[model samples]
Target: MSPLIALRAFDDSINSNSSVDGVSVVKIIEYVVIGIVVLSLLALGYMGWRHRYNLKLLGEAIAHRKEKHALAHGRRTKDVQ
Candidate 1:
């Protein structure tokens, strides 16, 4: 809605016609549904982004452990312990 329309709607008297009141209940329901869908998508994107960071950290940890293990045990001719 335009700024002028918003101001007009708010300035209208109590006895005057309510632009919002004329709006259909279904339209309100549709808005609610759209809001829910948008929120859900945002949540999904956030989760994916967070998990990517977590996976990167996990990979670094694994590499660090492998390096530590190699350092603790000198390289042998055979891969066996």
Candidate 2:
């Protein structure tokens, strides 16, 4: 659902007053499952982003090390004499 629709639904849920005040077992379980699913998705996304960043950093580090090693060995050019 779009953000607007979700926001409207949330607003409605919050504004409406139910006839019964007590919470149902089914509702509790549903809420728990929804929360868990949302959290799991968030965690998965974060991990994926972190992994990408780490890979990029590793690539950069490797490239830097290669450049430094080349300077140290005085073999910067790839062309053979």
Name the best candidate (by TM-score). 2
**Which ranges of candidate 1 are over 4 A from the true structure?**
1-20, 75-81
Could you give candidate 1's per-residue lDDT for residues 15-79 as a string of tens digits?
44434778744445557877998999999999999999999999999987887787689743335
lDDT of each: 0.70, 0.73
- Give a tens-digit lDDT track for model 2, residues 18-80: 324665444555567779989999999999999999999999999889978998998773555
Candidate 1 differs from the real structure by a C-alpha RMSD in angstroms, to one decimal, of 8.1
Clashes in model 1: which pairs?
Answer: none
In candidate 1, how many Å is residue 39 off? 0.3
Clashing pairs in 2: none
Least accurate 10 contiguous residues by lDDT in model 2? 17-26
